[model samples]
Target: MNQTSAARPLVSFDGVSKHYGSVVAVHTMNLEIYEGEFLALMGPSGCGKTTSLRMLAGLEEPSEGEIRLDGQRINEISSIERDTPMVWQSLALFPFLSVQKNVEFGLKMRAIAVEERRQRARKWLERMEILELAERDISQLSGGQRQRVALARSLVTEPRILLLDEPLTALDANLVVRMQGVLARLQKELGITFVYVTHSQSEAFAMSDRVVIMSQGRIEQIGSPKAIYRSPASRFVADFVGANNILSGSITETGEDLKISTAVGEFHCEKNSDRDFNTGDTLDLVISADLVQISMEGPEVQNSLRCRFISEEFVGSIVTIFAELEDGSDFKVQARQRDLANMALEEGAAFFASWNAADAHLIGGNGA
Candidate 1:
């Protein structure tokens, strides 16, 4: 919350890499995790997210590079000795143990006095809103309740860093939403560093201060969710972070702003980052389907293009219209039903799709 104090990262991954014989689980990872920040590592399966977390937890050693915590190197630190606690997906609570006992398991292992451990466990259980179930058996608790108990168990020790590995995957959708809020509030209240791993974009965007999008054992991009979504650094990130219609195009002009010529038309794009582009350069443009608007009649808009409606998909509040350009290239546009009703569109109908120049992002290479 306080940017001044949070300027310095609490954990730094300096050119870290981990290899398993012929396989590279993590390839030259370099990252800075700020203190009290909730950072999420997101990617598809086998993208080194779990491997990276394992290396941080000292469960696996990096074949190359170093890991630092609070300015001290922690690559050699053992899992139990490090000033961090991990919450596994399984909850890992003993089936026969009461909620209170399960929550205090770590403290007891550390040789804390029984009374002190109970006091701490009770405090955390109450904080997690599970005090009433302190004596309930783990098997009797619901998925959400078990998750809270596991969190209380981890937080009871008051670790400076918390590592969560898809801790909400087992919960239902409604409960997952509820837990996302809980985790967000907990991070703000505790002011502790949290490194979370998940494959869910909604979860990462909803709860993280910054998101690290990983792909094939490497980081694709690292930034706030908005930046990552709006201005992805690479094609992989652009496609992964959200719904995008990736188009192949060439740069017809380059200067103060970029002008790309695609199958549909030549369009101008906002210049935010220093991306190299020149006339006749090939590039990719990622435009979100939701950002485009469709109308039966063409609007006098700069980026508007005429297309034929191929199909329509009704999804809750918005309808996704699939359309094809004169060149036979297809893209999707999402509009509310009321907006579509205004157009009175039909299948195989002619329509114009348009978006702001600023809404399109240039990726991959200079559009030629």
Candidate 2:
């Protein structure tokens, strides 16, 4: 168990459900967010990630159940009284206002004195390393600078919990990475809870201490990024996480060494204690693309597939090879560019994809 899990949760959504008339935005969500932890709500559009965040921020009220803060019921709390300031995707900064005044907006709303609010805003601006640009207009500042200003405004109140909704979406690639570092560092320095909602998997996996995967207004899974990536709890999670090739098959043999029969071939997998497998039970086999190896000649591995190369995608040092299996299903293999430089890879060329049984995981099996 995580140490944070052992501690009392700072925020709890107990049997929470949100319904917008006949449509369900969130359903029976039971989640505990710990103090000072950076938690990300991740999913595709309309997956209710944003709705969940909005509920916690008091922007939307749940149709059923309770939203608790520090063991007290706060479902009816207004957004301002909740102390959960949201940094929106738009930044929502006033274009005509100077950066300093923009950062002071939140404090000003709370009826804070002019001098005190200015001091607080300036303090946060310095912390965000944008004090020099504080006097400039919002339009004059860069995207990253504007982001800092928005963050400063949100943090000016020194709220115990902060909400962010795709705050880095507008920045360029390089700026996005830089802001990710800034957010991570800021979260660590402040030791306050950060509830971030984003559809980008890279952002969630890169910065969050824990990620909540949602789909169709329901929580699919909640775990560390590594855990969810390595061992997806459901087929939706496996597909959404990417880099995973799921093969549907039926169990041929079970117990210590589990064997599954698929269109490609029979493959062995390690039995997991969390699930029970029996003969003739149907299941899905999940193999990560990075764990798979491609070669012209077949290697003596527990699992092997002869696939025709479809394409190769290059991103920095990594290369992802897309191939077609015998059943016409897509298979992917990810490797370092240097590792496959010697191999003469061509489109439509056949290659053997292999991985050890230990690297293969089973999902959708009986008793799962």
Alpha-carbon lDDT, every model: 0.88, 0.91
At residue 316, candidate 2 shows an lDDT of: 88
**For residue 273, what is the lDDT in candidate 1?**
63
- Among these predictions, the greatest TM-score belongs to 2
TM-score of each: 0.94, 0.97
Which pairs clash in model 1? 251-367, 251-368, 280-368, 281-367, 281-368, 282-368
- Predicted structure 1: clash tally: 6
lDDT by residue for model 2 (223-307), tens: 9999999999899999999699999999888767898999889998988655567799898999999999888998777788999
lDDT of 2 at 38: 95
**Residue lDDT tens for model 1, 83-123:** 57888988788898999999989999899999999999999
Best by lDDT: 2
